[model samples]
Target: MTDPRWGEAFSTAFAQLTALWPDKVAIGAAVSGLCALMETDVALAYICFGALTADMTARVAVCCKRNRPLCRGLKRALPRYVCYLVFIVMAWAAQVAFQRGLHVGLPIVDIMLAYLILTDMASIIGHLHYLGVPVPPVLKWLVFGGREQLKRKAREAAGRERR
Candidate 1:
């Protein structure tokens, strides 16, 4: 299983990143993955997922069309290309770190799980924000806590039943 703390950290990081740059960074990262995915079979499915994210960006672009302030602000901040470059480099670094047993401090899978959680949280929050929905901070935190609590409760209940 993945470390729960990673997801929490990821969510926090994602929230901050999205708050700063909105969807441009995310769309760029997704596009970068698509470029790489086209070159590898094992990664092709992930590339398709990236393409779906690009679609989301297109939607956001449409939604923000009339909001010139938000549009120009997001456009001027960062290039999607840089974000995509960072995404690939990070993935490569993580793989290298794993191969070198850098994950001795924690399982590599757990680290990956953390990034996944962070990414998912970022995506959902960005999407909600894009649609002008009010995403509650308490509710966002619960996304991390609820699953762990449910799992723990289930385990305890199972143990009791066995006894």
Candidate 2:
């Protein structure tokens, strides 16, 4: 029989995921094995999760403020390309976790789960923002708190572009 703890962990993770995005049950399933590791190791998993979450938020806020077809310029786009590289590496790791969780194992799965969970949450939040949904004020201050610097940079870039 499968461990009851596994079921418990999956259920809790699934509930949390659905709370973030109503259709995230599949994503929850994808990361469920990693969730099991989270149940086993709380502090480390959460710290990694928080780090990835912050990283992703900054990327999203920056990208949202950028021009479309993101990689247009050589010099001006270097920072955005760096963020893209970070995203690509994280995505590759998530694929490894989903495809080879059995072979690669715990710490890999744990870290990937944190990254996947937070990325999934960020996607949902970005979609809601695009749809004109209002963010909860507390969440705004927490997740988007660093946006002022990004805004300043964007304005500086705009002034340069107009010159």
User: Which candidate number has the best TM-score?
Assistant: 1
| lDDT, model 2, position 16 | 85
Measured with C-alpha atoms, the lDDT of residue 108 in candidate 1 is 28
Best by lDDT: 1
lDDT of each: 0.53, 0.51
lDDT of 2 at 60: 53
TM-score of each: 0.34, 0.27
Please give, for residues 1-163, the per-residue lDDT of candidate 2 as tens digits: 7567988899999888668884566555644545453333444345545554554454455556665433433334346435643654564565466447535333433444444444445554665666477878676554454344444554674476446
Write the residue-wise lDDT of candidate 1 on 1-163 in tens digits: 8667988899999898779795877776775565454332334335434643554464456457656555553563335435544654565565556456533222222333334444445555666666677989887677556546645654674475445
The C-alpha RMSD in Å for every predicted model, in order, reads 18.1, 16.6
Candidate 2 lDDT (Cα, 0 to 1) = 0.51
